[model samples]
Target: MRIYGPSGTTIGSPAGNTKRSGSTGFSLPDDAASTQATRPAAAPKAAANIDALLALQGIEEDPVERRKRSVQRGKGALDVLDDLKLGLLAGNFDASTVGRLREAAANLKASSGDPGLDAVLSEIELRVEVELAKAGQF
Candidate 1:
């Protein structure tokens, strides 16, 4: 069946239409038609795959919450590093204390947009790594 408009012209005539395949009677090309036809079967599988990926990544926090958490982690890492520095200066730090500092450096990753803070963080990580090596725990 063909549809005619008000002027009695077939609506889907293939003249000057690149979207239509002439051999397919002004319809979608064969490959495109097959793709459109198979969409329903693929949709559910695609959705399931996306859900699985999100699950693996964990629930995504909003930007504000993410930034806040990052800031908190950076703060905690800085605090621990401060104590380690003081302990070093005082000449009374144990292997486990250095281990905690190493763990902090390994896990924390945040830049407070301050170059000094980033430099201090790098120093802390390096200092902890050296201490761990000296203790034969690295």
Candidate 2:
């Protein structure tokens, strides 16, 4: 994965099977040297400009607010899923209804993207749907 400079020297991660040499790597190519010489030295000025942009926008880091937002999103998803499960269980269950319920449960599991939770929810929903169908609830 490591890319190398033109001089056969490692510049980035070692190419397939190579390892990093602490802090420094092999030499640069002659072309690389010429390129470096011609390159404008504007890194410090760019960094100052970035800092000014941040200050002008009055941006500040807030880890607590970020965590709160994440928690709220998680709770909202959970609430929607809970409501779906409850509705599925309470609905009449004919063969066609059961099939639809199974499809919905599978879709829910797929969209949630968590295999463990998907499995548990799928089991609970499928068992209830099957029982209701057998009892002629539909």
Candidate 1 backbone collisions, by pair: none
The worst-scoring run of ten residues by lDDT in candidate 1 lies at 37-46
Global lDDT of model 2: 0.50
- CA-only RMSD, every prediction: 13.4, 20.5
Residue 95 shift from truth in candidate 2, angstroms: 20
- Report how far off residue 122 is in candidate 1 (Å): 6.9
- How do the residues 81-127 of candidate 1 rate in per-residue lDDT, one tens digit apiece? 67767877898876667667677767555554556655766665676
TM-score of every prediction relative to native: 0.41, 0.26
Which candidate has the top score in lDDT? 1
The regions of model 1 sitting more than 4 angstroms off are: 1-57, 109-138
* Model 1 accuracy (lDDT, Cα): 0.61
- What digit string (tens of lDDT, one per residue) describes model 2 on residues 37-90? 565656554455776886655345354554444444444444544554666688
Clash count, predicted structure 1: 0
